[model samples]
Structures are given as structure tokens and as C-alpha cells.
Target: MSDALGYASPQHYPAVVTDRWGRVETTLVNDGTAFGMILRGNRFEGKSVDGLALVGPPVGSNPPTLCDGDLCSCTIEWRMPIEVSLDGAGPSRVSLSAHLVLGDPTPNRGIDSVGVTLTLHLPTGVVATTTPQELIENALLDLQRLLPDGTRLLACISCAFSDYSPAGTAFIGSMACFRDRKDAYRAVSGKRDMYDIWSAMSGVVQETYHCPDFARRRPGSGYRG
Candidate 1:
């Protein structure tokens, strides 16, 4: 990009984008100064990006073999597409592809397990995205508006009957409903005194997901997540 714009020396730094697991996703490269470009001469290029091939990425540490008529036996491929929408805006599409390749019968060795390599593709310009906390809050407010005048969006996050687990949350949440045995399990959920009583019947719940067993949390309970 610098050569295209006639730059002798480049000073702008490139910012990398990554997934939650700290894996490389994409990068934002600046080629020139702001005055000569659109505030910043940012380029979103994927041609040279490693592990971008749909079949087999040569840049991978161990390039996977898809198929070899003489040396390979069976191969399987999997693909999944997900669309994410936030704040009632245009959704962004994310897709994942995987391949399971089995080598042909060998004279020297038996079939062994191989490692997995994943490559993610993101939109050049993200349309709309929000943090989990913000999304939860907004969803609750919207749900409350649709309910009756006196009703509120009561879920695990907003229920006094629910509390965090000993190991904290596992993505969605770690809170469990103790409305079944409020007295025995209300103080702390899923960890402590009610350890034995808490089972699948009163399991962990999503922070924003709605449920029938409803209970409002007290003000300043320090559990309003």
C-alpha cells in the first residue's frame, strides 16, 4: 500500500484484530499520513494473510492434506455460518469451516490423531457490535417495556434468588435459581451451603434469558450484573 501511494518511509503503525481466544483475526494497516488520506491511510488487506485458504492454508504450521488419490482415503468438511445483530442494525455474518482428513492405510504406521487449526474471517468494516453487558441491559429494558405496566424483566442476573458460583461465570453466567429452596440457597448460589441441593433443576442460567420462576433483586445487592 505504501508503494501504491508513493511513500518513501512509512511511520504509521499497524493495529491487529483478534478473537476472544487471542488468535489472529485481521489487521488495520496505515500506509500514509492523515492529511493525504481519509484521516488515516488504512488498508484492509487479506490477500497476504496467513491461513486464509478455504481448503488448506499453506501458512499453517502443519499444512493439512485435503486429499491424495493414491495416498489418502477419506475426507470430510464442515461449515457453519452465523449472523449477529445488535441494536437493531444490519447484521454481520461470520462463517467457520473445518476439514477432517484421514490418510490412506500406510505400511509402516497406523492412523494417528492430528491437531486442529482454525482461521476466522471478519468483515472489513464491522457494522454493529456491543459488549455482552450492554446487550444484556438493553435487552432487559426492551423486554420490560413490552411487559405490563407493573412488571419488570426479571432473570437470573436481576433475581435475588440467584448468585455466582465458586469458580465465577462460564461465559453466559454462573448464577443458579434458588427460588425452589430460597431459604437454604439464597445467600450464595451453587457453591457453599446449597452445594448438594443445586442440581440441573436449579442450574446456571443466562444473564439475560427470561424464565417463569421470577424474583426481583434488591437495590444495592451488588449482584446487578
Candidate 2:
């Protein structure tokens, strides 16, 4: 089955994540038969540098998982230590920008990186007194501690809105790129939502493994005796 485009079976797509400097940070490929990729360590670090610091860590050893039958989905969660300094000596708010990329190979190899801006509204004392350069430097230094390895900047897209909305204002978040990876003709597709398809893919696998057929299969039991 295919969508209205008449393309038989969906295309095997790839997901890309770029940084503010227009570099390819992460690359996720979804082949029609299997899904896998070698994500750049720096790119992952860059993500943590972004506003993703709020998520913290997984509850247990088995970090959250997701799956989608044939497709592969997974989640990479982590946290960065931050110290808020409000000694009545800095700006009232701080803003930072990041990006994401979606890539594929079968259909074509395209990139999509959208800029994500994070604004930290400070308290009354420093909220209206800090300098843009100083605030940016502090945030970058904190992010560097969190990243360490550096990140990859992918293709450039448009500006996106954040999810953290406190006091009727939005905070920092990520813009995700979706790929089917089932068909080769249309691998790298575009999406404007923050649904985290990677996690969804992992869930699908968990469900499949729970089924009777998969449960009955023994590990390394392939022999024609």
C-alpha cells in the first residue's frame, strides 16, 4: 500500500540533524528491510547542548524503548548539569540556537536541519541587566561542559517553536525529521512535529519481541541437522 502519490511501498528514508554552523551532525537511515546508522558522537553531544537538558536520565538500566514492526525506533536520553547565576548582574534572558537533519540512501540522500532557539528568562535582578555576549558565553560554556566532543551541523531549514511554555511563553525544544525507510525512492521525507519517531521505532520492536513467534525462537538456533 502507498500514499496518494502512487509510490509503491514507502521509500526507505534517512534522518539528518544539523548544527547552527550548517554541518551534518547526525544521520539516521531507514532501509526497507532494516534500519540502522552510525550517529556522530559530536552530533549527539550537540543535542544535549540544546534545550534537551530538561529530560534528565532514564528511569532504569533499560532506557525507554520503541518499535514499529519492520521499522526501527530508538531513543537517546541524557542530561547536562547547569548552574543558574542570578546575582543581580546579568541580562534578563538568554537565547541559543540548534538544528536537526534527516537523511536517506535508496531514494536519495537529502538533508534537513532546522534552527532551534532556546530562551532562558532570568529573574528580575539579572533578567533586565545581563549582556547578550555574556549570557551567550555562559550558556555556551555550560553547553561545552555538557557536550565536550562537539556536534555536527546538517542542512539548513527554517526557524521552529519550542515546547517549554511557562508563563504563556515557549522555551527550547527540537524539530524532528521523519523518514519511512521502506521505499528507496523517497527516503528523506520532511516533518514539522516533535513526535520523536526514534522512540516510536523502538517501541515497535519491543511489541514484536513479545509476540509468541518471536518468543519461541531460540537464540543462535539456525542449523539444518
TM-scores, in order shown? Answer: 0.31, 0.17
- 196-222: candidate 2 lDDT, tens digit per residue: 223322111100001111111122211
List CA RMSD, all candidates.
20.1, 23.0
Clashes of each: 0, 44
**Model 1 weakest lDDT span, ten residues long:** 33-42
TM-score of 2: 0.17
Q: Evaluate residue 106 in candidate 1 and report its C-alpha lDDT on the 0 to 100 scale.
A: 50
Candidate topping lDDT: 1
lDDT of 2: 0.22
Error of 2 at 36 (Å): 16
For 39-128, candidate 1 gives per-residue lDDT tens digits of 112222222111112222233343222222121233323333333233333444454232333344455543333222222234432122
| Prediction 1 TM-score vs. true | 0.31
